[model samples]
Target: MRKHETYAQQPHIRIITGACPHDCPDTCAWQIAVDERTGRAVDIWGHPDHPITRGRLCGKVERYLDRVYHPERLTRPLKRVGPKGSGQFVPVSWDEAIADIAARLQQIIAEYGAEAVLPYSYAGTMGLLQGEGMASRFFNRMGASRLARTICATAGFEGLTYTLGAALATDTEAFAKARFILIWGSNTLTSNMHLWPFVQEARANGARVIVIDPARTRTARAADEWIAINPGTDGVLALAMMHVIIRDALYDADYVARATVGFDRLVARVRDWTPERAETITGVPAARIERLAHEYATTRPAAIRINYGLQRHAGGGMTVRTIACLPALVGAWRDEGGGLQLSTSGAFRFNRNVLERPDLLQGREPRTINMIRLGDALSLDPARLAQAHYRPRPVDPPVRPEEAGPPVKALIVYNSNPAAVAPHQQAVLEGLRREDLFTVVLEHFQTDTADYADYILPATTQAEHWDIVKPYGHYYLMLNRPAIAPLGESLPNSEIFRRLAQAMGYTEACFTQSDEEILREFVEAQTDPVFEGITWERLVRDGWARLNLPQPFVPFADGRFPTPSGKCELYSERMAEDGYDPLPTWTPPATRRNADAATVWQQGWLFCISPPAHSFLNTTFVNVERLRRREGEPSLWIHPDDAAARGIREGALVRVWNERGEVHLRAHLTEDIVHGTVLAPSIWWNKLSPDGRNINQVTPAEESDMGGGARFYDVLVRVEPLAVASEEPESTQQAVSLA
Candidate 1:
């Protein structure tokens, strides 16, 4: 797919069309070009008639015109001239930053209400029509607070809508029609990289793969076998490979009796989870879980994929409802690339109340919040943000922060950063050092949550605006129009929520629609039969479409599954009527291994933290300077027997830490992870680390088990070396001191 010709060698060099709104799982498409002789954006790639981006583009959008002509993008709006986390600032005027963020969100909803206003976001520009569509209908017409958006695959798509009533996937070209793949806790070569060239063309037509993962990734260096396993014991290796596929009978008994129902209570709940109790909770051995459950119950079509870092731990939703009942006990949905992916993104029905209008949430219960407790809702306490009351279960009867009600006092933060990917990190930097929090941050860079903004604004780049995408790993339906226009005074997050709903006067018709008429009324409010006959003039003349899925789709191959008895729910009275575990097992949380690596290694705590970066995604391009000169610094890996049980050495520099924050890296000994685990991977921003903090500063607002998700592989930590490569970074009582 390499063909290029510059007919634009004439008329002002044009090109255009877009998609990669990067919170990736291949929403690729691409195009760009634009040159009016350096009025900028000269070339980005992929899109040669994309179908799951066949025309190639990763390694961060093939350096997408070096992060959209990076001269540090964020063109205007700044404000905060120094002090809060201090990157400092100044410049302004987008009508003076939308009339001072709509008069400090109408004076925090007239003094501490509208849940004291909070917004924060995710997928950092995942662009479903301006990511978090019109900032969730301008904070649900400003009652401003409900954000649970379960940080990444809510416990594996609520364990595939409690056992395959949904969570589809198996067609992004059916993993090249698999013979046996698996890959599990993903790193599909640095995250869904076009499903690793169709699983390397199904391993060059023979297929096999394997992987599992407790690290050793780059797709377990292109696996035929990797298996490391241990962090939150992947549902003890999928209940010891479904107890060796129901003890060697090799399952699929007449497709588990014509498509599942509690197949003998999931075979008496895998008898006693054998394979020597999943090789002592997945350090992986019982003879490789009975020879990979007899080659995944006698291979045939078999597949697996499964990611979202194994639900991000605390036995992540019973390890994704016990690995989605192992492809319905090996019937593997009767073929095509067998079953188990983890997010077909609920088969795209995007009307989303035409992007979160929620009919103006006038029924407004608004108070939800959970984005991993944005550091306890920005250090709550303006009398708990004028308490209206909240504790129904926030950690089962653990409510006390004076029963938190409000205290955000207007935050907005589009497409997230939360002090470099949240979760405890010095209590989200002391709740972003809350001097009566007002923040704002739209961002493009100045991120570290726009250095604790008091307004940072200036967004743009998805090659400067217009969006409409869909990709929890490919099904297509793309379009991202604007290739240039708003690069300075940069707009489009639905025109910055249509200039903050016209500086908060909001005479709403969905705040004056237009962005191709709200993407043609969000594609004529799609009524999902995978968008039958999909049109917005056939997505503006085929810029990208693909949803009608059929050929080799094999959707549960005729067992009829959208649940409530139209099959496949291997034991689930809707998961014991929603308190979970009608069958999905692996209980695991008495604080998993209760992290006592011997008084947490005599109290420096080190067990592990930070992980998404086989060249960065979670801190997207960790400030790309050509992917930080091809990701050099950020080190840690560990295991030369935990770097000689932590006197650490190979390249030395250490620190790590625990009671919730501390950074410093370097170590790299590696058995490719698993020996009291240690990795780190890249996180950057703390002024590109040397430890002013990154890796969610010792990561721990904990959560996950059923999807409040944010465990960074249940971080444990305790590293240590620095006898002085000019040591520093530790203080916050030596990072949560124990002695």
Candidate 2:
């Protein structure tokens, strides 16, 4: 009320250039603004000029400004003041927190060699230096425990690696030139909104868009034709299509003869999977399947857009492998508009240089474990524990007899929140609470995972950091510049690692270089002649840069694949060696209906949980009022017929229970979903409830050992209304919106 109490002056606008770092299909470039003096970001928008994103912002990114400015963001480091998972903590000075963390880590390393510590991270933040590089350098220098290289995209990469010898795809611009576009297992309109415009353009040019998915999605609604197959039955549909292509003699004989190997075996394997046979398993009609196969084979210059969701099944890897064989079989790779496109970023031209970096992790070689099987790795495997002592080199110092398991005496978590994002939340929590394990989490907020940490380090948001981000799913090379200073004692991930290295008294040159210097070193090691004249400064000035390649448009011309045989292998020998069918084959997932069933019925409804493009990023966006208001809580989406059959009402409290676990939520009755399937938005956990609202509770953690991913959709659950329902219920479940 005082006369001098004037409001602080906010900047008219500010700009910070960076891109979303998640493993999402749309790698968006963002612009953030802050008040000149207060150093508080007030507005955030999408970079309209970026070629890939074309200046569009999704709901999640638009509301992200609220997340950075949220009142509950961890401004300083903290130490646990109560029992783990109790959500009680006391603020501590940065010095004390860092010192305490360093002491505990050193003690653990001294008592049980450095390998006792495990550094867990993932696509939480995709900054090249901040996320992967910093963690890799710190862990390697300390001789920390090993981490499995591929968790999310292993199968997709492995499939492409063997077939193409490299995981590269044609450019996104080439999609317009295609005569037929096969969109497989990807909801491009909703999941990749920016790319939707491009597809619309392609459609305008008379290119037919064929959507193939288990559920009818937004993209399917707009497609020229929609093919709804059973979940996990994608391989079957792909094989059936191949059968029609081979049997009818629609293939490009000269192209196939020159560029491919093992055609006879692939032809033989697909012979039995006729459209009629596939119809029984996939639930898609035989006539439509035959029509699509013919159309795709006859349509010259066809492109396939494969999404990452398909890999989340037991046979996901094999399904991708099977589907990848189609383009090769039809000789689609011979044209610029042809060739199967899984991830169209076309960054393999640059990624080759990154893999060849000798100074990146010079002398560090540590033991490794599979990332998908974190629960098993942390759990007490008595037999494996007994054999642990006799196992080879790089062993962690022995733990006490009682402190058994996979020797993770300490953990350093960065970017990722496994407590909310991992398959089994309870198991991850239990592993983190190990008495002997010292935990340190670098986070922007007080997340569920950070709540249990021995020390919680505040990290700079994308707006408060400087680095270069090369998207895994897109071709744009983004330059992230610091628009504002770090809030409170928050630090960039790179600086944090540097300080940690100094604290540990380690002499590793890789850890000593400045961020710019490291980037320069990487830019100089370019094996791709296209980048021969480019520099880091040039990239920063341009805001973005495209790598030049000899044949930038077409990838597999001249019949020379990167495979050992220099030809695309429809029947991969590597898959055969791994005890899998060499030729692309199909088997019904355990979840599908039997042929004898009078009516098509599923044991449990398929749960298609996807990350909301707007208000969902694990636990990060839950605190944003606008986004949270728009998408209140998780809702179980069911078809009207299914709800009527179960005697369930709309907006009623429903309990969805499966073999793994059960959580209470609200039921949304709509015809948007298939009759027998259910859709739940993933990454919802309630801190207030004794039993949290995590969907993983009901999600089975059954490993798709074949694919190296989780079969999240394979779960079937029985839904029922709450026994006691008041007109105005005291307890309200979370609600999600279709928008």
TM-score of each: 0.34, 0.88
lDDT string, candidate 2, 1-739, tens digits? 2111111232344455667765566677776665666677766667667777776777787777666667777778888888776767888987687677777878888887887787888877767788777667677667776665344666666666667777668567677778899988888776677766767778888999988876677788889888876667788888999999999999989988999999988877888999999897777899999998999899978889887677666567778888888888888888777777676444536543342233544576555655544554555554333322211111234334454434677778888777776665556667767765677889888777787787888888877777777765556676777777887788888888888877777676666788777777777667676566567777777667666655445878677887878888887777666666677765444443232212323332434454343456655676677876677667778888888877889998787765445677778888766556677765664562234757766554444536345566555556777664224222111111100
Q: Give model 1's TM-score versus the native structure.
A: 0.34
| lDDT values for all models | 0.75, 0.69
Q: How many backbone clashes does candidate 2 have?
A: 6
Candidate 2 overall Cα lDDT vs. reference? 0.69
Q: Locate the minimum summed-lDDT window of 10 residues in model 1.
A: 385-394
State each model's C-alpha RMSD to the native.
Answer: 23.8, 6.6
What lDDT tens digits, residue by residue, belong to model 1 across residues 211-317?
Answer: 98888877887788888976767887888888778877888798888888888877778889898877866768898789888998898788888878777766577
Q: How many backbone clashes does candidate 1 have?
A: 10
